[model samples]
Target: MKKNIKNKLNNLKASDNYRVRRAKDSGNSHIFRFKGNDYLSFASNDYLSLANDVRIVESAKKALDIHGYSVSSSALISGYSRSHMLLEEELSNFLGQEKTLLYSTGYQANLGVIKSLASRGSFIFADQLNHASLIDGSILSRANFKRYEHKDVKELESLLNKCPDSREKLIISDSLFSMDGDFAELKELEQSLKKYEAKLLIDEAHSLGVFGYQGRGLVFEYLLNKNENIFLTGTFGKSLGTFGAFFSGNSDIVDYVMQKSRGYIYSTSLPIHTIEATRASLKIIEEEDWRRDKLFSLIRYFKNCIKKSNLTVLESDSHIQALLIGSSADAIFFSDELMKRGIYLPAIRPPTVEEGKSRLRISLTVDHEEKDIDYLINILDMISQNLVQ
Candidate 1:
C-alpha cells in the first residue's frame, strides 16, 4: 500500500502538480512572514479585512471567557446553545429567509443539503465550474445528475427541458464562481428553473458580505430572493471573517435538513466562541459599508491596470481576479517570481482549475492599498514581458 501511494506521489511531482504546505512564521492584515521574510499577500480570502479587526478579536475573547472552545457534542446531543440560535435567527432575518440551519463548515452544508433533498428519482442540474463541494454533494445524492457548461443558460435550459415534469428537479450553482470570479446569470437561471418548476440552491459563499444592499449577496441583488423556490448557502469564513456556514430557506426545508442531514446530525457543532465571533462579524458587515466600497475600488483599479498589460485577465467583477498563465509549470514559476519580489500571490493549478487553464488566483482585500495594486501590476508587467521574450 505504501509503495503504491509513493508511486502516485512521484507521478504528481513529475506532472508539476505536487502540492506542499508552506508554514508562515507570522502574519498581519496585508503581509505575512515566511522564512523570516515579509511578503505582501494577495492569496487570502479575508475580503473585508475583518479577520484581524480589534472589535472582532475582543468579541472572541469575551466569548471565550464565557464559553470555552468546543461544544463537545453534536447539536442534537446537547451541543446547541443560545449563541448558535441567536446567530441563526440573525442570519435568517438578515438574508430575508424564513429559517436557517447552521453547519460546522460550508463543505458539510453543501454535502448535507444535496444528499438530503435529492434521491434516486430526483434530477440535479449543476453548473460545470461550481466548487468541488457542490460536485461531491451531487454525486453523493444518488440522483440523476447532469452538468451544464459554465454560465451557459441555453445549455442548462435544454437539459432542463429533457427531464420529465413528474420528476423532482434541483438546480444548483455558485452565485459567484470561486476560481474564475465570474457570476452565474442569476436572472436567466431563475427563469429557466421557474419554467421547469424546479427548486434552486445557490451557494452564495463568495458574494455574501461583498455585494448587494446591506451585503445580502448577488441573489438578493438580482431580486431572486423573492422566489420561494430558491435556497441560499453562505459561509462565515469568507467575507464574514469567521468560521461555519448556514443553509437558509423556508421553515419546512430548514426543518427537513435539521432532521435528516447526516452531516449535521453526526458532527459536532461549531465552537461557541466562533459563533459569537461570527455574530460580531455580522454586525461589522451590516454597519461598515466602506469595506465593500474600498474593495470594489481596488478591483476596478486593478482591472484598469491589467487592461494595458499582455496578461489575460478573465471577465470578473468581484474581488477575485484570475490572470491566466496556461500551464502548471509556468503558473508556478510566475507565482515564485512574484514572491521573490516580496509579493505573495499563489499559483492555482490543475484539479483546482481545469488543465491548461492554471493561473494566479488573486484575492483582493480591503486591507490592500492602491500602492499594493500598483506594485502587483508592475511586477506582472515585467513577468509578462519576460514570458513573451
Candidate 2:
C-alpha cells in the first residue's frame, strides 16, 4: 500500500503537478519574506490590505480580553456570543440581506448552504468552473447536479427547462470566478432564474470588499433583490483580510439552514476575537473608499503594462489577473524564474485550472503601488524574452 502511494506521489512530480508550500516567515501583506529574503507578493488575496491594520488588531485584542479566545462550543450549544451576534447583524446590514449565518470557513459555508437547501429530489445547476466547495456540496446533497459551461446562461436555462421535477431547483455559481478572475454574468443569470422560477445562490468569496457600493457585493450592484430566492455566501479571509464566512439571504431560509446544516451544527463556532476582528474589518471596508480606489488604479496600471509588453493575459478587469502560460512545465519555469527576480507569483496548475491552461494568478492589493506593478511587468517581460530563447 505504501509502495502504491509512493508511485502516485512520484507520478505527480513527473507530471509537474506536485505541490509544495513556501513558508512565509512573516504576516500577510503584498511583500512576503520567504527563505530570509523579501519578495514582492502578487499572490495575496488581502485586497483591501486590512489583515495587519492596527484597528483590526486592536479590536481582536480587546475581544480577547473580554471573551478569552474560543467560544468553546457550537453556535447552537453554548458557543454563540454577543460578539457573534453583533458581527452577524453588522454583516446583514452591510450586505442588505434579511438574515445571516456564520460558518467556520468559506468551504464550510458553501457546503452547509448547498446541503441545507438541496436534497435528493432537487436539481442543482452550477457553473462548470464553480469553486470546488460548491461542486462538492452539490454532489453531497444527493441532488441531480448539472453543470453548464462557464458563464453560459443560455445553457443553464436549457438545463433548467429539461429538468421536470417539482422539487427544489437551485442554481449555484461564484459571483466572481476565482481562477479566471471574471465576474459572473449575474444580470443574465438573474433573468434566467426569473424565467425558470429557480433559486439562485452566489458565492461572493472573492468579490466581497472588492466591488459594489461600499463593497456590499455583486448582488447589490446588479440589483438582484427582487425576491427571497437569492442567497449569497462570502468569506472575510480574502478581501476583508480576516477569517470566517457566511451565508445570507431571506430570514426563513437562513433560519432553516442554521437548523439543518450539518457542517455548521457539528462544528465549533469561530472564536469571539476573530468575530470581533471581522466586525472591525467590515467597518473599515464600509468606510474606506480610498482602498478600493487605489486597488482599481493598480488593476488598470497592471493591465496596461501587460498589454504594452504583449504578454498573454486572460480577460479580467478585476484585481485578480491570470497570466496564461500554456503548459505546466512552462508555468513552473516561469514562476521559478520570476521568484529568482524577487517576485513570488506561483504557477497555478491543474486541477485548480485546466491542463494547458496553467498560469500565474496575480492578485492586486491596496498595499501595492504603481512602482510595484511596474517591477512585476518588467520582470514578466524579461522572463518572456528568456522563454523565447
TM-score of every candidate relative to the true structure:
0.98, 0.98
Candidate 2 lDDT over 39-146, as tens digits, reads: 999998998999999999999999899889788999999999888898889888888888999999999999999999999999999999999999999999999999
Could you report the Cα RMSD, in angstroms, for every candidate shown? 1.0, 0.9
Q: Which digits, one per residue and each the tens of the lDDT, describe model 1 over residues 14-112?
A: 889999878999764577789999999988888998888888889889989988878999999999999999999999888888899999999999999
Superposition TM-score, candidate 1 onto the true structure:
0.98
lDDT of 2 at 389: 83
For candidate 2, give the lDDT. Answer: 0.91
Error of 2 at 100 (Å): 0.5
Which 10-residue window in model 1 sums to the lowest lDDT?
24-33
Least accurate 10 contiguous residues by lDDT in model 2: 219-228
